[model samples]
Every structure is written in structure tokens, then in C-alpha cells.
Target: MPTSDAVLDPAVAARLTRDAAGLVAAVVQQHDTGEVLMLGWMDDEALRRTLTEGRVTFWSRSRQEYWRKGDTSGHAQFVRSVALDCDGDALLVRVEQVGAACHTGDRTCFEAGDLGAVVGAGA
Candidate 1:
């Protein structure tokens, strides 16, 4: 159920499937390049803000508050588009990134060396 302060569209909210914590995983990407940037979490309020405010907003699980990207870091993400995954439990936020997307000043959060895995053979 949406909170008392909910402002999300009813039709859109009805399609969501929030976790026990009322959050959906939001995967952010570079709008034009399609580079995967980072993942954030969002509750209904955060999603609503991101959709309407032209900036990416996230629900901070650690801080237990709402945070707008690039507010303090100056690495703002301007929302270009947002899409809910088929399951309605995840979100894809395409943005015009201003600076590093990761908190560590990296371009992407997946910058750590990849774990060795068997290469897949395409059909």
C-alpha cells in the first residue's frame, strides 16, 4: 500500500510489486551510450519524484532517508527515461550523467574486476 503522502499515479502504482521493505531495485544507465552505471533503491515516493522532478531520486537503505543523486556530490543524473521491468519489481533509469556515477568516483559501480567464469558459446 502506498503511504499517506503518496503522489504516484494510481494506475502505475498498481503495477508495482514492492519488496518487504517497499523498495524496488533501480538500475541506472547512461542514456545515449547505454553504459550500465549503478543501482539504487526506490520506494514509491522516490520513484514519483524521479519521474516528475527530472532528477534521479533514491531511497537510501543505509541512511534511511531519501536522497537525490548529484545533490551533494555534484554528479547529478538527469532523468531521460524510466522503465519498470516486466516483473514490476525493478526499474531501469536512463539518464544524462554529469560525472562519475559511483560513489567511489568511478564511472560505474561494476568497475571491480570481474570474477572468472566460463565464456558462453552462442548458438
Candidate 2:
């Protein structure tokens, strides 16, 4: 759901901060559960395709291709809503995910990482 205040157009793309490789960070979240599934890179075309196609599409930095989530695997992510951060450097994509968002076959990419090591056990 795009709001009138946030337009997904060429102007918006121009305002965003992309790296030298012309990519911005996109964080994908589970719509209902509010679970952050994964982070992917997105170029302007990928962002446009995500809005227009009604599915989450990403610029694969490793493969150097456009990968629509669940395109190759059955675990697809349908766009429930999208929000651009105030800085225009990142996007929060709330999706109705169909299956695992991780390549490792886990429900989410963050599950494998040890949060305790970074955040500390007591803190």
C-alpha cells in the first residue's frame, strides 16, 4: 500500500542513497507477525518491479540477476505493504510470505545468527 505522501516514482528513486554499485538496502518483514525475514539489495528497477508486480523482487548481488522471491523456490513473498524510511536509504517491505525466506530452508534468515553474541546474554 503506497501512500500519497510517499510516491514510488523516478523522483523518489533519485532521492534515495545508493552505493557505488547502484543498490539500496531492502528489509523484508512478515506482515502479520512483524518478523523480519531477510535483507536484500534493490536497484530502482527492482523496486519498481516490486510495486508494479505486487511481489517482492530483489537485485541479487551474488548472482547479478533479478530474483523475484519464491520464483525459483515455492517460498514466495507477496507484498502486503511497503514503507520507505525517512532517510530514503532503506525500505521496509511487509509481506504475506508463502514459505521459507531463507535459502537454508529456515523460516527466516535471522534465525541462524547468534543474537546473544552481538547483544550480550544479560543485556
The TM-score values for the models, in the order shown, are 0.94, 0.85
Write candidate 2's Cα lDDT for 28-95 as tens digits.
Answer: 99999999999999888888889888999898888888889998899999999878888888999999
Model 2 residue runs over 4 Å out of place are 1-8, 117-123
lDDT per residue, candidate 1, 13-50, as tens digits? 99999999999999999999999999999999999999
Candidate 2 lDDT score at position 3: 22
Q: What C-alpha lDDT, on a 0 to 100 scale, does residue 102 get in candidate 2? A: 97
Clashes of each: 0, 0
Q: Cα deviation in Å at residue 70, candidate 2? A: 0.5
Top lDDT prediction, candidate number: 1
